[model samples]
Target: MTTPPYDGQPQFPPGQPGQYPAGQPGQFQPQGYNPYGQAGQGQGGYGYGYAPPGQLAGWPIRVGASILDSLIISIPPIVGVIVALVIDGDQDELGPGGGIAMVTGFAVGFAVWVWNRLIQQGRTGQSFGKKLTGLRVVHAQSGQLIGLGSNLGREICAQIFNQLCILNVIWPLWDDKQQTWHDKVVNDIVIRL
Candidate 1:
């Protein structure tokens, strides 16, 4: 019997329609075939996956936000001190009323700071400072809001570093990821909105 003539198209083995033949060097794989099984899935941008690099909040903007937040958080306590001084004018010691005023002021300020920075930020990813600065804190990998645990951890780490005189707020200035020590500890990143 005469052998059939060779066709122009290359033949694939049975049951392998789009796969390249085994042992074929330099052969292009079929379109849309991803060996890692991630075909057609794009990397997430913001709020789902990590924001693209180079879009993180810069040090200057973050510093400005910190300053603003500091001023805002200090207002109540300053007012309280003033009121205490007025109430206790010319007194060598602070009376009970003056003490109460000072304590109340400090407590109110502390409560406001905690609410804004911890609770609100945990739920919404933005503190007052972050909101004003158009920045947000998110999971570094997932780009989701950092929850209360992460937020608290971040704050604790920051406080520890601050106590150590390490200047945690300025850490992002020299960090490759633009993350402070607390951010790194919590696997969080601050990104522009």
Candidate 2:
């Protein structure tokens, strides 16, 4: 155990200068201060891709939104049909044309489709009913939310796909990653966007 020139002061070993002296880990020598070290590196905080979210909330959120959207959009047509019914009795009018059943059906269908399309078009990518229902359409490679043209493609497929015998709706279910058949055709995914 070497001692300092003063006799008992703790000193660094002959070869190790900046290292802790002796067995005392707390004893350190001088080095330049690192006040800015690791700056912007996020060492003291969450970095990129630190942790992924545990649960997916797409379906639940979209389902709730659909109910809300349906209720809200259905109001106009419902009111229109009621007014039409009172005015025309069995006639057609400005509020809605034809008998109550036909008028109501037309109004409801039109309002629903319009509202669905508008809302879907508002987001990062367009998703009609199924898209709004917790499923996102994105490019396969970039994993990015689809843009205008692709989104339009997806929306069109989704809308008319109702007639494709089950292939229309069931495609997403069969996808390895849960993408719809329409998604496959469009090179997209029904993922959490």
Candidate 3:
């Protein structure tokens, strides 16, 4: 029997999806076949996992956001520390309240951090500081807000990297995608709204 001429359709065995035919090395690929699993530039700007879309927020703006957030979270704790000191007032030791005010202040500050960084930022893509700066943090691939769990991990990584070296914060200055180490770990990008 004579074989049929190639009609541009992949010849797959029955019960198989339109996958690339196997054992036919260098054969013509099916339409829309992407070995990398992402569409080409014509489809959707190269899809995800390669390049994150949207205009990246500037480093200065990002730093501003960080500073703003830091100040907001620190206010309570600083006030508590100041109050505790004033109460002690040259005493050899802490006053009757001891470190209660300081502890309470830190707790409040931690709560604020959780709410702003993990909860709000995860759900809305913007923490208070980012919102004020007209910026957002989103998944690098999906271009959507990273969830709370991811935000938590990202925050932990950020802390660790920041403690390890100040480069983590400043790395974005010269990065092609402006991603810090924590951002890379979480597969995230910062963009201006």
Most accurate candidate by TM-score: 3
Candidate 3 ranges with C-alpha deviation above 4 Å: 1-54
- Give residue 121's lDDT in candidate 1 (0 to 100): 85
Ten residues in sequence with the least summed lDDT for candidate 1: 44-53
Winner of 1 and 2 under TM-score: 1
Q: What residue pairs are clashing in model 2?
A: 58-134, 172-179, 172-180
The candidate with the higher TM-score, 2 or 3, is: 3
* Residues 30-112, model 2: lDDT tens digits: 12111123224332321221110111224345445446555656666677666667666754344334356556756776767
The backbone clash count of each candidate, in order, is 0, 3, 0
Quality of model 2 by C-alpha lDDT: 0.46
**lDDT for position 143 in model 1:** 57
lDDT of each: 0.69, 0.46, 0.73
Q: Write model 1 residue lDDT over 13-85, tens digit each, in one string.
A: 4236433343233222222322224535432211122222225778999888777778888999999999999
For 83-130, candidate 3 gives per-residue lDDT tens digits of 888877767778667488888889999999999998999888888899
Candidate 1, which segments miss by more than 4 Å at Cα? 1-50
As a whole number from 0 to 100, the lDDT of residue 189 in candidate 2 is: 48
Query: What's the true lDDT of residue 114 in model 3?
Result: 93
Clashing pairs for predicted structure model 1, backbone only? none
Model 2 misplaced regions, further than 4 Å? 1-75, 90-115, 118-123, 126-135
